[model samples]
Target: MAKDYMPPSDFLRALIDEDVEIEADDTATIKRLLSFFKDPDAANRDWAVFLLGQSEVDTKAVRDALIGALNDEDDSVRAEALVALAQRDGDLARPHVLEALSAEGVYPTVFEAAALCAHPDLIKPLRGWLKATGDKEVDQMVAEAVAACEASAK
Candidate 1:
C-alpha cells in the first residue's frame, strides 16, 4: 500500500491550494510563490518550478529557471520546463522549440513544447512538416496554431 504523502511547507500547501482556486488573484499569489523556487528542499524547489509554469505572473527569474530546467537530468522536469518556457516566451523560445521538434526520434514532449509555443514563426516549420510527411495530427496542430496566431493578431 502506498503511504499518503504530505507537503512539507505551509507556503507550498498554500501554493497548491492556490493553483486550484480560479477565483484567487494570480498576480499577487504567483509573486509570492516564485520565491519558493529557491527553497532548500528539492521537493519544494520542484513544486515551485511546476507551479511557476501554471502561474500567470511573468518575470525574468521564472523564465531563466524554466529554461534551465530544459537541461535537467529528469525527463519529466525537462518536459515541464520546456512547456513553461514556451508558455512564457514563445517568441524567444522559438529556436529551441524548433530544434527539439526537428531532432531525430522527436519526443512527444518536444511536440508538446512546439504546440504550447503557438508562435507565428512556427507556422512555417509546421507547414513544412505537413508538406513533407502528410501527418494529419501534425497538420492539424499547425493549422490550429496558425489560426490562433491569426486570431491574436486581429
Candidate 2:
C-alpha cells in the first residue's frame, strides 16, 4: 500500500533531515530547491546546487540552473554546480572545468567532477592539481582523476 505523503513546511530543515527522503518524481520539492538559488544565504545556494547535482532530476532547467550557479560568489556553490554539470554533460562543462582547475585552490568536489568527466583534456589540469595540492587525500583524488582521464583516452 502506498503511504500518505506530506511535504515539509520547512524546506531548508527538511533538506538536511536524514529521515526525509526526497522522492524522485517530487517536482514540488525540486521547484522549491531551485528557488533556493536566489537566496541571499550562500549556504542555501550551496545546498541547492549540491542536492540538485546529486539528484536524478535531469532537466534543461536544472542544467541551466546548475550552469548559472557556476558563477555564484560562493566557491562551494560553484564547485557543486560544476560537478553537477560535469556529471550530466561533460562537453558543456569542459571549459568551465578547465577554468576552475586553474584556480589557486580547486574545491575537492571539483576533483570528483573531473573524475566523473574523464575527459582527456582534463589531464593536464589534474596533473597540475597533483603538484599544487600538498594534501595526501587531495593528491590521491587527483591521481584517481588522472587515471580516469587516461583510461577514457584509450
Candidate 3:
C-alpha cells in the first residue's frame, strides 16, 4: 500500500526559511516544523528531524517525535534522532543508541551518539564490541565512547 504524502505547508516552508523570521521556541513554529517529519522527500524528513533534534524545544511532543525518528528509514535521520535523544535524555536514550550498534551500516553514527551521551552503562558493552570487531577505526570510536562514558561518570 502506498501512503500519500502532502506537500510541505507554506507555514512549514516559511518556518524553515533562512530569511523568514525564526523563533526557535515558538510553539506554533515547533508544531509546524515537527509536522515536516512526514514529508514525501526522505531528505526533507531526515533534515526536519535533524533540526528538531537540534532545536531547543524540548517539549514532550518534540521528544516523542525525535524518538519516533529513531526508526526512520533514512539512516542519517535515525542517527540524528539518536544523537539528539542521547543529548536530551542520556539515561533514557542510552540503551537504544547502544542497540543501533548491532545493526549493519550505522556503526559510525551510532557510535558517535553513544559517545555524545557518555552513558556509563555503555562502557562494558562497547568494550566487548571493540574486542569482537577488531577494526582499528571502530576500536577508536569505541575507545572514545568508553572514555566519554567514564569521564561523564567521574
Candidate 4:
C-alpha cells in the first residue's frame, strides 16, 4: 500500500519453505518478524502472526511477542496470534482464546485458532455459529472448529 511497506513476511517463507535456505540466523528472522506484529498495516501484522505461528522456535522472545499480539488493535492480528499460539503452543493459548471468545463479533478468525487448539469448550459455540451463519466460508470454518475440538476430545 505504501511506498516503504515491505511486509515482514516477504523473506520469512524462505526460512519456512524447507526448500529455501535461511541466509541469516533464525533468531534475527524471528525478531524481525516480531516487529511486524506492530506494523501499521493490519495485513502485514496478520501475515506475520500467521507465519510466526507456523514456526518452531521456542525462544522466550518469540513467545512474548505472540502473547503481546493479543493486545493488537486489529481483530485479524489478534485472531492470527491466537492461531499462532495454538499451532506453536496450544497449552499456552487456551486461556487467551477463551477470553477472546467470550466477546461477540469475533467469529471465523477466532474459530481458526480454536480449531487448531482443539479445545472442547469451542464445540458448542462453533456448532451454534454453523447453524446461524449462512455464509458458506464461515460455516466451513465453524464446522472445522467443531470437528477439531470433537476429535481432540477422543
RMSD of each: 6.1, 6.3, 5.8, 4.4
Q: lDDT (CA) for every model shown?
A: 0.62, 0.83, 0.72, 0.74
Q: Per-residue lDDT of 1-154 in model 1, one digit per residue for the tens?
A: 0144334878776767764442235655565666655555656655666667776656776687777766665555565667678787877677887776565534444555676676666656655554343577655665665565446545
lDDT ranking, best first? 2, 4, 3, 1
Give one digit per residue, the lDDT tens place, for model 4 in 6-111.
4555554454455543232566666777777888878778777777776666667777888999898988778877887787778799788777767767646777
What candidate 4 gets wrong by more than 4 Å, as runs, is 1-25
RMSD (Cα, Å) of model 4: 4.4
In model 4, which residue pairs have backbone atoms overlapping below 3 Å?
none
Clashing residue pairs found in predicted model 3: none
TM-score of every prediction relative to native: 0.55, 0.88, 0.75, 0.76
Q: Model 4 clash tally?
A: 0
Query: Ten consecutive residues with minimal summed lDDT in candidate 1?
Result: 19-28
What TM-score should be assigned to candidate 1?
0.55
Q: Which stretches of candidate 1 lie over 4 Å from their true place?
A: 1-14, 19-46, 104-109, 120-154
Model 2 alpha-carbon drift over 4 Å, by segment? 1-9
- Assess the local accuracy of residue 18 in candidate 3 as a C-alpha lDDT between 0 and 100: 51
Model 3 C-alpha lDDT versus the unseen true structure: 0.72
Model 4 lowest lDDT segment of ten: 15-24
Instruction: Give the best candidate by lDDT.
Output: 2
Residue 50, candidate 3: Cα error in Å is 1.4
